[model samples]
Target: MKSKSIGLSPKSFYYGYDSKKDLKHLVRLVLILVFIALLTGMIGIWVVYRSAHERHLDMLRAFANTQGDVLDAYMLLDEVKSGRVHGDTPHEHNLDNVKELLLKQESFLETGQLLLAYEDTSTGKYILIGTGHMPSGQHSVLVVENTRELTPSMRLALEGKEGVLEGQDLHGAPVVTAYLPISKHNAGLVVMLNQSEFYAPYHRARLITLGIGVVFVVFGTWVIWSAEQKNLRQVREREQLIRLSFENSAIGKALVAPDGSWLRANKSLVNILGYTEDELLRMDFQSITYPEDLEADLDHVQAMLKGEINVYHMDKRYFHKSGDIIWSHLSVSLVRDEQGEPKFFISQIQDITERKRVEFENQRLHERLMDQLSLRRQQLDTASGALEGFAYSVSHDLRAPLRAMSGFSQALQEEYGDKLDDTASDYIRRIHRASTNMAELIDSILRLSRTSFGELNVVSLDITAMSKRVVENCRVVEPDYPVEVRVAPGLKGQGDLRLIGSVLDNLIGNAWKYTHGVENPLIEVGQEHVTLSEQSDDSVLAFYVRDNGVGFDMAYSNKLFRPFQRIHSDREFEGSGVGLASAQTIINRHGGQIWAQGQTGKGATFYFTLNHTQFDSEKNSTS
Candidate 1:
C-alpha cells in the first residue's frame, strides 16, 4: 500500500539538483591528466634538444682532432727536413709550409675556421702564426705579429695539453673551439665553429616540441572551462568563503590603494589600531603614521612603485583610535594589474610594542653598565699610579742597605784575607753572595713593575739585527764560555725596540747560561706559523729561541714564568730565578704570550708571539 507523503513528492524534492560537486571532481581529474600529458611533451622536447646539441659538439670535436693530427704530422715532417729531431723548433721555411697546409685544409672543414698560434714564452703572449681566413667585415682570425688573449683551451694547449672549450672567438662571436698542441714546434692548432650555426637544428626541433605542448595545454584549458561553466552556483559559494577568510584572518592584513588609501582591512587590523572599520576606511596610511616615520615609509613605497624593490618591511609607529601610539612590524608588497601597472599594496602587520619596550629597557641597562665601567677604570688608574710610586720607593730605600752589606763583606775579604781564619773567610764569602742575589731580585721586581706600567712604543724593528747585537754583547760579557748562536735573517716585526731588546737579551742569556758544561752548546732563533684560539687561520708568527742545553722536566713548565720559581738550585743555575719571569712580563706588556717545551737533560724551546691582542690572567702565569 502507498503511504501518505510526509513532505513533497519524490520528483519535486529531487528537482533542480544535479550534484555539481561530482561534476567538479570529474573536471579536476581531466585537468590533471591533461597537465601530465603536457609535462611529458615538454620533457621530450628538452631531451631531443640536448641530444642534438651534444651530437653536434661531438662531431666538431672529432673533426678538430683529425685536423690537429694532420697539422702535427706536417710539423714533424718539416722538423725532420730541417735536420732537427722531433722536439726542436721548426725553421721559418718549415712554418711557411705548415701555414700553407692549414690554409689548404680549411676549405675541407664544413663549419669552422682554423688558426695556428705559438705562445711567446718570454712575453707570455699568444702570437698568431697562421690563419685560414683573413679579417673581413668583423669576421676575422688573429693575424701574424698581433697578440691574442689566451682562452682556457689555448692556455692548456700552450702547456702541451689538448682540450675543448666553448667561448668567444677573436671577433667576439660565441664559438666552440678544440685546441691541440704541436709539441715539437711549440705551437697549437685551434678549430672554431660559430655557436649560433651549431645549435640552429636543435633550436628548430625544440620549437616544434614546444608547439605541440602548447596545443595540448590549450585543449585541456578549453575542456576545463566548459566543465567549469556548469558549476556557477558552487563558484559563488567559494567566493563567499574566500571573502569570509579575508575578513577573519588572525594577522593584520590590508589592501591599500596605490595612493596610500586603505581599500580593505581585516578585523585583526581594526582591533590592532583600535579603530572601527568605517573610521579606517576613511583614513590613509600617511594620516596615522608617526610624523617622524612617515618620510622613510614613503620613500620605500615610492621605491616599490618605481620597481627598485619588490617588498619592504619596517618597524613603524601608528596613532591608535584612543590617541595612544602602537608599534608594529609592517611588511608591504606591491601588487600589479594584468597590464603591469600599479594596482594596490598588500600589507601585513604584527604588533611589536612589547618587544619594543624590552629593547628600550635593555638599552637603558647598557648605558648604566657603561657608566659603571668608566668609573671603575678611573679608580684603577689611580690605584696603578699609587703602586708605581710605591715600587720606586722600594727600589731606592731597599737597595741602600743591601749595598752596604755587600760592600762591608767585600772589604773584610780583601783587607783581612790572610789574618782571618778559613771559617771567617767562608762566612764573608757567603755574605757577599747573599747580597748579590738580593740585588738581582730587586732589579727584576723593578723591571717587572716598569713593564706593566709604561706605554708601548710600537715600530717596525729588524729583529735579526737586534738579536745579533745581543749575542755579541753576551760574547763580550762571557768570553770564556763557549757558545754558538745562530740568528735567522730577515726577521722583522712590529714592537717596541728597547723592550723587545730586553726580551731577547733575557732569553739568549738564559740559553747561554743553561748550556754551560755541554759539548757544542747551540742556540737558534727563528719564526714559525701559529694558530690562536680566536682565529681560524694559522697565520700568527711565533718567534722562538731553541737551545741544546741542560733542560728541566715538563712537570715544572707551569712554573717557568713565575717570579722566584726556579727549577734548579742557585749553585747549579746561578740565577735569581727572575730572568724568565721578567721576560714573560715584557712579552705580556707587548700583548704577547710565552710558553716553554722541554725534556729533562735533552733541550728547551721558548716560543712567543709579539702581536697577541688578548690576555687571560688565568693562563698568563702558573700557580
Candidate 2:
C-alpha cells in the first residue's frame, strides 16, 4: 500500500528546503581546502628549494676556498723558483702551469670553469683568463675582453672580496659563481657552475610536487561531490515520509489552518517558541510573530493563498513565550487538496539566533575599525601640514641670519687684517667658515625635505649619458689626478631627470673625492641586471659607481644614509652627511633603494636601483 502524505507536494517540499544553499556552502568549503593544500605544497617546495640553494652555495664556497689555497701554493712555488711572485701580473709560464693544475682539478665537475683575473689599472677593467671543460679532454683558455661589463662576483673579487654569487658569465649564461681575492698577488680567482644544471633536480621536484597536489585536490573534490550527491538523493527519498516523520523531525515543523491557527505543532516548535504544543495550537501564528516581521509573513501567506507563490523562505524574528526575540530561517509553503481547495500550511523553522548575534557583532566591529581608520588619516594630514610649515620656515627665516653672519665675519677678517692680531684674524676666519658650513647644512636639509615631500615627475632617462656627464663634472673638479672613468653604454631608466642626476653626482662625486690620494685612481660606472630569484625570471637593473680609493669601516655602514651622521671624520673626508640621506629619500620616492659596500683602504661601490618597489631583493655585498 502506498502511504499518503498530508498537505505538501514533492515540488513544494524541494523548493522550500535549502538544499541548493547547503550544496553551495559545501562547494565553497571544498574550494577553500583545495586552496590550502596547494598553498602548503607551494610552501614546501619553496622550503626545499631554499635549503638546496643554501647547501649548494656552501659547497661552492668550500670548493672556491680550496682552489684559492691551491693557487696560493702555486704562487709560493713560483716565488721559490723565480725569487719573486706578482699575482696581479704573474709570469706567463708560471700562469700557464697554474692554469694546467686548476684545469686538472676541474675535471671532477661536469659544467665548471676556473677563472683567473687581474684588474688592468690602465683602463679600470678586468682581464679575464679562463679554462673550461672541452669535449676532447683538453682544456680551453679564453681571454675575455676588458670591454665586457664586470659581473658582481668579478667586481667584488677584484676589490679583495671573497664570496659565492649567482650571476651571468662572460658569455651571458646564467651561472653560480665563487670568487676569491688573492691578497698577496693582488689578483682574483673565480669558479663558475651552470645555474640551470645545478638547480634542475629541484625544479623538477617542484613540478612533480605541484602535479601531485593538483591530482589530490581534484580527486578529493570528486569524492566530496559524490558523497554530497548521494546525500541529496537520500534527502529526496526521505521527503516521501515527511508526514510520518513530522513529529520526530529536528527542525521545528507545524501544520497551520487557512485562518492562521496552528492545527498541530511538533516538539521542536514548542521548544523553539518556549511554549507547550497545546498553548501554541490555541494561539494564531500572527500573535507570536514579531510585530516587525508579521506584515511580511502575512504578505507571503496572502501570495501563497492567491496561487502567486508555492513556497517562500526568509530570515524572520519570532516573539518567544518568555518575551525574547528568536531569529530563525523560516520556510512556509501552501498545501492544496485534490479538489483545488486551499488546505493547511506546512512551516519549517531552524534556530539561527547565534548566527544573527555574531553577524551584528561583526558589523559593530567593522564600524569601529572604519572610525579608527578615519582618525588615523586625519592625524596624518595634520602632521603633513606641520612638516610643510616647518620646511617653509627653515627656507625663509633661517637663511638671512646665516648669510649676514658669514658676510660680517668675512668683512672683519678682510678690512681689519693689519689692525687685528693674528689670533683675532684666525678667530674671524673660523667664524666665517662656521657660518658658511651652517648655510651649506641648511641647503642640504632643504634638499632632503624637497626630495622627501615633492611630487614625482617620471620620464624615460638615458642613464648612461647622465652618468657620463656626472663623471665629467667630477673630472672637471679635480683634473690633476687623471682618474680613469668608464661609463657603460645604452643604460636606461624611468625617473625625474634632475633628481636622478643629483643622485649620480653625489655618488660619483664622493668616489672622486675619496680616490684623490690613490695611485691609478679608477672610477667605473656600470649596471648589473640581477635576477629576482631562481624561481622567477624577473630581473632588476642595479647601477653602481665603483672606485679604487679610500673606503669606510663596514661596522658603521648603517650610518651612511643618516643625516649629519658620518662614518669618517671631517679631517679624513669632507661631506655634508646629507647627500646619501637625500639620495635614499629620492630613491624611495621612485620606488627603489640605495646602498653601499666598502672596506677601509680598498674602495667603495654605491649601488642603487630605480622603480623597484621591493628593496629586499638579493644583491652581493661589495668589498
Candidate 3:
C-alpha cells in the first residue's frame, strides 16, 4: 500500500521552482542578438570604407610626389642635353641622368610602369618617346606611347617652362606627364615622366581589407544582441507582475512628473475621472479644476511646500473625456528627491461625485426651509404689530369710561343707597370691579404697543452705564425696595439707544418685580468677552443681567419670546408677560441674540449677544 501523505510529500514536490522553456523566445532572442551583431557590423563597414578611401588617396599623393620628382630629374636631363646643366653631356647625357633617378625611386613603384613624354610644339601633340626602370614592390612597371595622341607635352629637351598632360598611354595604363621647358641657344627642350601606375596594387589591397572588416563586424554585432535578449526576457517577466498589481489596487493611482507630465496612470484613476489614462495625462490639474476650486488647490499646494501639510486631501473636479465633470476626493503625497526637494506627486483618488450630488441637494432643501420659516416669521411680526396697535387704541380709549363707571357707581352708592337694596349695591360694586380689571388689561396692552412702535436713538452706548441708569430709575420708582446692581465698566456696543434702554428697562424691571417678597433683591450686571472658537479666530462680547427673581422652567425656553406665553399665572404675578418678549424683539432688531437661563424661584440670568464680529476680526489680528 502507498503511504498516505500527511502534507506535501517529498516524492511529489520538487525542492524549488524551475523555469518553463519558451522555444519561440529562444529563437527570438537569437534573432535580436544577430541583429545587434549586424548593427556593429555596419559600424565596422563604415570604418573600413573610410580607411580604404584614405589609403587609396595616400597612394595617389605618393604617386603624384614621385611623378613631380621624376619630372624634375628629366628636366635636369634636358638641361644637360642642351649643355645648360653642369654635367659631362654627350657621353653622360640627359637620358642617362633620368634613368638613374627613376631607379632610386623604384622601391615605391610596386609593379607599375613609368614612361616619359614631352610636347612637340610643332605638332601640338604629346609623344611618349622614352622608358625607365624602377625597383620592385606590390606593382610592376612598363612604358608605353599613346595611340590617341593629342597635346604637346612630349618634346625631348624642354626643361625650363611648365607644361602639364594627363591621359592613358597606348597600353591603357593611366599616366600623368609633366614637362619643364628648356631654352638654350634658341632651342626648346622638356623632360616628362609617368607616375599613377605605381598606386594600383595598394588600391586593390585596401578593397580586400574592407571586405574582411565587413564580415567580422557583422559577426560581433550578433553576439551583443544575444546578451540583450537575456535582459529583455527578465524585463518581460517583471512586467507581468507589475500588471497584476496595478489592475487590482483599490485606490486610483497616478504618477505625475514635476512639470505636470504624466508618467503613468492606473485604471482606477481613469474610472474616477471618467477619462482614459491617455486623456487625463494629456492635461494638467489647472485644466480640469473648477475656477472656484483652483485657489484652494493652490493654497494647499503652497502649504505643502512650506511644510504645513505632509499629505493633502481635497475634493476637486476633473472634466471627463466625455465632457462631463467628475468629482474626486484625492489624497496626494509629495515624493521628494534625496536633497528634500519635491520631485513629483503621487495621487490616490476616490470618486465622490455621488456624495457631492446628495450634499448639494440637501443644501438646497435646507435653504428652502429657511426661506419658508422667514416668511412665516415676517407674517407673525406684521400681525403682532397690528395687535399692539389695536391694544394701544383700546387702552387709551377705554380708560375714561372705566373711571366714569367707577365714579358713577360710587355716586349711586352715596346718593341712592336707601332706594337700592344691599344686593343691588353689591351688583354695582361687582360691575365696578370688573371694569377696573378691564382698565388694567387695556393699560398692559398699551405698554406692549409702546414697545412695538418705540423710537430708537441709535448710538454707541456703554451697557455698563445704561444698566446702572436702569437700576437707579428702578430705585426711584420704589424708594424702599431693596435692589443690588453690579455693572462692569467699559461694556460698549453699537445699537439703538432707546431700544437698548428698553431692553434694560424691561429686564431690570422684571428683576425688580419678580424679586418682590424677597428679603433683598439681588441684581448683578456684568460683561465678559468669550471666544466662540478654540483658536479665538472669532470672539463675541456678551452682557448678562442676573436677578434673584421668579424664573421659569427650562423646558419652555423656546416659548419665552411669544407674547403672553408666561409660565407664571397673572393672578400670581400681575404682568402682561410681554416684557421679556419685547426685550427679545428689540435685541433681535439690533441683530443680536437674547437668551434666558433660570430655575423656578432660584433666579434668572438674562444674557444678550451683540455681534461685534468686526471688532473681533480687528482684535484677533492685533493679538
Segments of candidate 3 deviating more than 4 angstroms: 1-426, 449-458, 528-542, 548-574, 588-604, 610-623
- Give the winner by lDDT: 2 or 3: 2
Quote each prediction's TM-score. 0.51, 0.48, 0.41
Across 1-623, the per-residue lDDT of candidate 3 in tens digits comes to 11122122222112122233344655566667666756776677668767864665455545544665655656665785687665533322453454455445443334234444444344544433333332223222323243234224433224434544554444455555444433422122222234445335446655775577556655654664566557566765666556556655677877655444554567887776676776765667667777778888778777776668899999988777676787889887776666886655677777788899999989888989899989987987788777876776687678888889988988888899789988999998998888887776676566656666655556898888898899888888788876767777787888888778888988888877888876677888886554555875565556888888877788888888777788877787767777877788777777677887888878888888765563466468657
Question: Best TM-score goes to which candidate?
Answer: 1
Clash totals in order: 0, 0, 38
lDDT of 1: 0.76
lDDT of 1 by residue, 1-623 (tens): 11112222322221323446656776787778877986887787778777876777777767768877877777677777766654434444565677666655534344467767775555555556434344542223354442336556666676787767898775577878877877766777677777777777767777876787678777777777676665655755665576667678887888777778776777999999988776776778899998988999999999998999999999999998888898999999987766887767889988888899899889889888888888888888878898888888878888999899999988888998889999999999899988888888888788877877777899898989999998899889888777888999998877888889988988888888889878899999987754555556434568889899998899999999998899988878877777788788878777788888899888899988776542232225421
Tens-digit lDDT string for candidate 2 (243-292): 44887789999888776777777788898999887788677888988899
Best by lDDT: 2
Candidate 1 colliding pairs, count: 0
Worst 10 residues of 1 by lDDT: 1-10
